[model samples]
Target: MTQPDLSVLDDHFSAMTWGWVGDRGTWTTDAARASLDALEQLGCSWIVLAYATLQATPQSTRIDYAAAPTLTDDEVRWGIRESRRRGWKICLKPVVNVANGTWRGFIGFFDQDVPGEPTWAEWFASYTDYIVHHARIAEEEGVELFVIGCEMVMTDGREAEWRALIERVREVYSGLVTYNCDKYQEDRLTWWDAVDVISASGYYPTGEWPRQLDRIEPVVRRHGKPFLFIEAGCPSRDTSPQRPNDWTLEGAPSGQAQADYLDEMFTACAARDWVGGFALWDWPAALYNPADAAANTDYCMYAKPGEAIVRDYYASRRSG
Candidate 1:
């Protein structure tokens, strides 16, 4: 397959991270359309159609993607079409998360499979099914990018499995494929060569962007592949700048803090041209009232100072 290039980023390389494993068939609602309308106003060029399925536990092998909590296949297709209709570039990101209150990064089995116990083989089979299912939809809809997986830290070490999964997806979905590694784990992925693009979650502290980028730079340069911060953004709280990855951090809602963190992020990434683009952490399918943005403290950029920060940054990068 011929690889796609970073020219896709052109000037403004940004996406409004939308969809979070939306409720069963809730994707095409009027509220969802309204949210997309608002996102359109932000000037982001891409829409990350991020959705997820759940495994019963960190050790569970079955990926129950058809469960009631997830969007049905119809909804997922509608979402892809809706975003395409809005003239946004699409990056279909299908994620697997663990239930049972455990972080998905802990989802793993022993290095060696034991009888009657779950094995990496079992998990990869299910995970590959979940990803390829969406990858086919991406191909049919002309999605420009396809992310095979997201932040599954425990599975990142299985380079051969990941490479095989990419091959499986390629057999059905012909598009640029990338994987989202957990923060600070860029160099850990020895199989970056298996995918067309390299991406990681960029949740380093406001002050740590320079150092983290320095660490990630050589990895991309060595592989000669485009890199993106496929998942990046800070929450609306003062404590977040120091640890943006901690979504549950306690602090008063401070949109300025989120704005400052992203402003610094945009500035730092500007110096690293290889830092091809970003898909900010998220926007909700059901948007909150803009009037309440100051008090609301999640990752949504609506009506917050970060919204303008993004708008300005995206606007600045465009060719008139």
Candidate 2:
């Protein structure tokens, strides 16, 4: 299939990340429309649609989510079509989770093959299948971009496998491709040349955006690839800025803190021309009541002070 025109992606993309959960039926509901409408009102120019698959453990390769209660293939297609209809650029992000409750970043294998144990070879094979399945879908649907994987820290050292996976994805996906490295791991990816863009999770601590950006700048320059924060946001908790990546951090809800963190992040990133833009950590498939914003303390910026900050920032970029 011929790829859709994606020249529009050259500009800065203020994206709102959207992830689905629960049964597939929810994708076609009024709730989904309301959520997208809310995001569009926030002035997002792009939507990063993340679909998750699961494995029993980092060492286990059996990747399957279609059979689970998560979002279905039809739901994903609907999301893509809806995003396009709303004039938002689409980045299809296929993520893998561990069913046994391990974070994907901790997914690792022995340095060398071990007898009678699950090996890196087995893991990569399953991972490749999971990624390529969505790559083909992204191609068929003409998504503007495709994210090969998200924050597979332990597996990142398998340079040969990652490069080969990118090559295979290229055969099916005609759009730009990228991998979302975990925070502080941007420089560790030696195979940067294999991907079209350099992206990482921007979960640096509060007041440390400059230091992190400085650390990342040389890598972007060296690789000569456009840079973006594929995922970044602080929860609406008092101390979230100090550890933005920790979603479970406890504290009273503080929209002001979240808003301030976003302000700092946008200001820091905007000053650097190489920093393309951000796809904020997420907006949910289902939204909570706007009236309850003060009590809620997750990363979702909807109906909070952070939401306004994001709107202003994105609107400023659009007008500028």
Best by TM-score: 1
For all predicted structures, in order, the TM-scores are: 0.97, 0.96
lDDT of 2 at 92: 93
Tens digit of lDDT per residue, candidate 2, span 115-170? 99888888888888878888888988988889998999988889999999998898
- Tell me the TM-score of model 2: 0.96
At residue 4, give the lDDT of candidate 1: 57
Models, CA RMSD each: 1.3, 1.7
Candidate 2 deviant stretches above 4 angstroms? 1-6, 20-23
| Whole-model lDDT per candidate | 0.88, 0.87
Expressed as tens digits, the lDDT of each residue in 228-298 for candidate 1 is 99999999998899999998899999999999999999999999888888999899898999899999989
Candidate 2 total steric clashes:
0
